[model samples]
Target: MSMEKISIIVSKGSLEGIYPALIMANGARAEGIEANLFFTFFGLDAVSTKRSGHVKIGAVGNPGLHLATFIGALPGVSGLMTRYMARKMDRLDIPPIPEFIEMISDTGAGLYACKAACDLFGLTKDDLVPQVKDIITVGEFYEIAEGGQIVYT
Candidate 1:
């Protein structure tokens, strides 16, 4: 049987954005689907060992945090709060970020960093996680996502 593909675009640098992509892609792969993650702009940090684990959850002065803690929490606000808590766990050396990224990649998910973004950031292929498949253009990413469901996170 031909496996269905799920393409995920990650555009944020925060732990909130990165984990969802990893979780979803890993989940898709667990179900035997072909999973691909495209990292662009700040999202490239998700696939970069140097930056992936360093993401800070914005708690202080964050509009979302203020809204969640005050004026009653939104429907999905708890999840955001959970993500913020997880960042603190990292400080305790629990479930390191690299381990999480490895867990996702080990499931056969294809990871790609945006070539344009890499150039803009002065990052080379060597700067990314060793598991990354390639540095590709947005066009190349779209070509991969053509027949699949594409999700932006």
Candidate 2:
């Protein structure tokens, strides 16, 4: 039987969007499915080593900003929020984003940086996350996206 392949296209800059793609992609691999992730647009920052660590919890102009800021400002709320996100993933049987990305990479799920997007952001291949398998054009991604489920999160 052919393996089930799922391609996740991550395009947002928020933690909510970034984490879900990583979690789902990794969850697919845990079940022995072939999963791939294409990071483009603002989503590229989520995977960039220089930017990933600085990823902000949604706040200021974000719909959830108040809640996120409240949680972030509360004593121990930052840790709590972090744990809450992790727990939510656990409830869904998915792993945390960082670990999920690691597992997805380790399991051979294709991880790619969008070259055009990268250029738009003034980023070089070296600026991307180390997990990136390659820098590819949209056409290349479409080639892989063919005949497979494509998800944008």
Candidate 3:
């Protein structure tokens, strides 16, 4: 049976937060399912050419670290976590962010930037990566994902 269309919204800029949305969109495309990814607020970083590759994992206040929240904020700790996450991705064979995004574009998955978000952030199409097909309104988003799953990340 054909999989249903899937719509994913990514509102966070953190690597750990964004990866699930990215991976799911890629997974849906690989399975021949229609997928749409919408970026809003800070999530725009994922589709912004200048920021896409630099989105980092947040180590602060992480429950798994078992450290006081303040320790996570130590100057080098965030970077350390980012590097460690990168290594883990490397071990798991997850491609770097840019390549993964391009793969989604090439595979026919729809990528969109929220219209109000773009305006709110004072951004334009030129600020976004080439993968974004359109800057769509909330109504347009709902229209695209009609009858499909709506996942907010």
Candidate 4:
């Protein structure tokens, strides 16, 4: 069966964790599949105007980092790795998070923030990036996701 739509649930706050959802959403849009991104829990950081740019890699306890846990926990390690990855992604022509969000939005994909998470984090609609269409409950998300595949990233 063809995928007419997709609903991506982004629940991670780390740079690495957030990129996959962004990429998948962008790719789906490029393929002419209706796409939506639901930012919940820690994932809300990716849509936070104040914190998006500062989101760092979670080096400690991240198996993909390949560094010893103690070494990964060292001060500046997460920042250093985040910069390195960002530079590499730039070289590969990947736009930064904000730009990527703009591009995806321009493609007519939906972007939403979790209302519960926003309440827990003391964030109002103004606290999120302008691209976010609305802050919604999980029930609302599921309603919108009806007839589409829901992917948790």
* Candidate 3 backbone collisions, by pair: none
TM-score of each: 0.78, 0.76, 0.95, 0.98
Residues 1-153, candidate 1: write the lDDT tens digits: 565999999998876677778778888988889999999999988778688767755443457565545433445455566566786877865465578778778888888999999999999988998888999999999998889899999
Candidate 1 CA-lDDT value: 0.80
**Which prediction has the highest TM-score against the true structure?**
4
> Ten-residue segment with the worst summed lDDT in candidate 2?
56-65
Give the local distance difference test score of model 3: 0.91
Q: How close is candidate 4 to the true structure, as a TM-score?
A: 0.98
- Model 2 regions more than 4 Å off: 1-3, 64-98
> Tens digit of lDDT per residue, candidate 4, span 1-153?
899999999999998879999999999999999999999999998999998888899999999999999999999999999999999999999988889888999999999999999999999999999999999999999999999999999
lDDT of 4: 0.95
Off by over 4 Å in 1: 1-3, 60-64, 67-84, 87-95
**Of candidates 4 and 3, the better by lDDT:** 4
Candidate ranking under lDDT, highest first, comes to 4, 3, 1, 2
Query: In model 2, how many backbone clashes occur?
Result: 0
The residue-by-residue lDDT of candidate 3 on 3-98, one tens digit each, is 689999999998977899999999998888999999999999999988999988777888876768999989988888889889999999998888
- Clash totals in order: 0, 0, 0, 0
The candidate, 1 or 2, that scores higher on lDDT is 1
